[model samples]
Target: MTKSYVVRYVGGPLDGRVDTLPDLPDEPRSTVTHVHLHEGPKIVHHYDLCYAVEYGCEYRLRADADAE
Candidate 1:
């Protein structure tokens, strides 16, 4: 089975949300994409991995990416 890690979102609409995701690389920094429905269009948001915790990782919304 693939290893799963607890991921915590730090900012944006998903702030404070936690999810268990599989196969997140153990890198200091990385990007995760999220798709959401806004009105009738699908919007994509990018988050950057910023911190590592005991058993999880913390990702913050990218200001530049979120602006797009």
Candidate 2:
């Protein structure tokens, strides 16, 4: 049997504390994992970086096991 879960992201100015999203596609489920900055390309520029830093860049996505 396959297990399901809800992925919630804690980000943006609103804090996204109450925001939650469901994962689709039953074949494969989504899971959260840590990523290094060097692993991906740098997209944030001067303004974007400053805004993100000032507002706090602590967006954490947690997967909560769904109750079946």
State which candidate has the highest TM-score. 1
- State in Å the error of residue 17, model 2: 9.5
lDDT of each: 0.78, 0.34
Query: What's model 2's overall lDDT?
Result: 0.34
Give all candidate RMSDs, comma-separated: 4.4, 15.5
lDDT of 1 by residue, 2-65 (tens): 7777788888789989888676755645888889986888877789887565655688888973
Instruction: Identify the leading candidate in terms of lDDT.
Output: 1
The clash count for each model shown is 0, 0
> TM-score of each candidate?
0.59, 0.20
lDDT (C-alpha) at residue 8 in model 1 = 86
Q: How many times do residue backbones clash in model 2?
A: 0
